[model samples]
Target chain A: MSAELRRLLAEVAERESERFARTHPDDDVLLYERAVAPRRALRRTAQASGVAAVAASVALGFVAADAVVTDRRDATPAASPSGTSLTPTGTGWTELPEDSAADAWRVSGRPLDAFFVPEGPDEAVLVGADVTGDALTTCQVLDAFARFQMLADAAEAPLPEAPLSSQRLGGFHGLGDVGVYEAEFTRRAGAAAYLALMVEAAQMCRQAVGGAAVVNVEEDVAFSAVAGGGMRVDISRDGTDPWRLWVHVQQGRMLTVIAEPGGADEVAPVITSYFTAWDR
Target chain B: MSAWHGVLEELIRQRRSALVGYAYLLAGDRPLAEDLVHDAIIRTFSRARRLENVGAAEGYVRRAILTLFLNNRRSRSRALAKQHLLVVPDVAPPDDAAGDHDVVVCALNGLAPRQRACVVLRYFEDLSTAETAERLGLSEGSVKRYVHDAMVHMRGELGDIDPGPEPTPQSVVLVKGGAR
Candidate 1:
């Protein structure tokens, strides 16, 4: 075939692929309808599967404190362990090499939502949906393209701090106006240890908080501690340290779901994986 | 609800193969593609109210499928990976593209997701640069640069069409000319 023909063909395939990816309106509408009327969609959705629609998370075996039942309607307050301060840092983490497929950081299963954070000024964070938490505590999602660049910049060598046990916090930007009050904490597992967080006032988030007050939606920010059959355990939420659950969101739906210290083992790997897959 | 189910029934009558082909291209899995289409059909049954133009609904349905693909990609890599199950072909992955399909995909992969999106919208969907910019909510200039940069890369990687300046290496910091 002539080169022109091949070029035309590739263009067609590429367009076809792009068009296909963009055509989830059906799924979107269904999700939209379902999001609005859970009972009706739930019955239909569940009837198709012979199960019940997601109304709320059933509190499992945690007996330490009162666990709030979070239905799809509201997010439960994050039961963060308090007292010990959380200092944030992008240190000690070996960022993925650019252009390398983030296979190592790929998410394991379905999540409530996936987040893609921007890595650069290239693609501005176009969408922000989650209106929960302290307005100070929401995660940011950017177009995945810019995130690649940001991840590359963050890929710098660890700050001699091996495990970023302690570091001064600062603000960070994501979507316009949102300032991020960021903090990080270290976690120790069997043989390896890693860092986690409690973000408060930082760049994009803190900026958003300062500039304008956002219209708070009814969805209560939740951190449901789901026990996934395997060796998942809850840490003492006394603020010293606790396990982390990460959710990724895009457009307004759940995109990626992951857990830190994933697979009853390494927390950093899980955290890294969450960051990698978390397209904000 | 998807607004294209009734339309799809008619579309299937007239364009089943093409619709399936689009689904296959989107999901990379035949069964999953059919399931996507079926689900889209079901949802469109309810959403037909919001769909203004019956004739233009096909474009909307197409857009919906694309969004679903991205959502699925975002949600879970492994389970969503299931959507790409290989199937025998009527509409297989168009590997036998007459042009630089590999080049285009690779060049696209090189772009920031947004840039690639810009290129896709401008050339692939045949949208004007301004239309593409509006759709993506980006500045016209940004759209132009994305298209230019994308084309240049596509030229080098896919074919001999020299579109513009060479692409910067992934690791290099983009330097503005420092002629003081």
Candidate 2:
């Protein structure tokens, strides 16, 4: 039986090989240029920009978690040198209106508050908050945990052996129904690893969404690096309305902030505000 | 120009079709098989491995292809999610002229990714159980079980069709204590 199966497989393989060779006769120089060259260029760019050094430190497990956390705490107070008020008064941020219960509902009671929102005519509200340690895993496990697990297994990184807890926040986005999630990990190394995994997952998610046969749902994932040391993952499902997802691993905490549809230009301020609040 | 690039070009020029054929056996799709080959090439060349020759390069690419296929079982679930959109009619009688091709391919596809990989490495690639285990990062016992289970499934699918009295190859002799 085994021999027969082998013979059959060999026959099929031969037939398929001939057919594929005949059909795809052209040389794949384009594949090499597209896939291999960009990776090489990216490596050179990383080496030049000093990002490679930070990656090496994280990979070596030599990053000090305490120092990162201390830096964040120190940076927050330094922003307000007088030490009188923690919240920014003239930062173009306004307190939520008391009667605007619906808008408040969009921002209130999340793990974090609406310290930052999109600065445009459309009222973009804060949708997520800072959840640390196990809370981060609990919030994101259903959506991206399998990807994290696969990446960790591939890299041989052992995850913390703690039970993940979950809390589902319910509400509808001003544009459409969008989900906002936030989480922070305890260790900088783990956070850094997860950040890398999230980038890869974003790429895979983009492919999955593009390949999905579902009609009338335009899904996309656009990932890019922020100016500082973090990455932003933008996921758009509704036509022309992108749901922005920001992931920052700083000060020994991994922060993921997701927001509903707003102007793309408004992303930087929100990130800056979140980091400022996180430092405090 | 680079050593890896030269080796990659040579491997593509020489072994691209063979690699695609191997991937097609695992993926059971033409376009996906080609994608797997291309992805495997990128994965192999992205890392600075010491590929001394085209043979060594081919070996690395093959391993990468296998890894990519096994890791991408998530696509199976995505396909299942979209199965609702597919309309199925009544089953037709098996085509006699097509021989056992459909039976074999369908049986191969029905097996779990790892099980199918084990069967391919065992029968198609003619590797020993230990070699299959090493390639798949599984224990020898696990490889034996997967191969055994795969053969049992194939046997059930193929039914009692006699394969004539052809002699088994020497490589098949090494796969002892499993499915024999």
Cα lDDT computed for each candidate against the true fold: 0.33, 0.50
Location of the lowest summed lDDT over 10 successive residues in candidate 1 chain A: A190-199
State in Å the error of residue A135, model 2. 46
Please name the candidate that would achieve the greatest TM-score relative to the true structure.
2
Candidate 1 chain B, which ten residues in sequence have the lowest lDDT sum? Answer: B171-180
CA RMSD of each candidate after superposition? 20.2, 14.0
Q: Write model 2 residue lDDT over B1-180, tens digit each, in one string.
A: 356667877887878888888998898776677767877776677553466699988988988889889777335543453334222334532333355676678888889887899888988888887788778877676777777666667767888533323222222222333221
Candidate 1 interface CA RMSD, Å:
11.3
lDDT of 1 by residue, A28-72 (tens): 432323222222222222223211111111211111122332222
Share of the reference A-B contacts seen in candidate 1? 0.02
For candidate 2, the per-residue lDDT at A99 reads: 39
The candidate that wins on DockQ is: 2
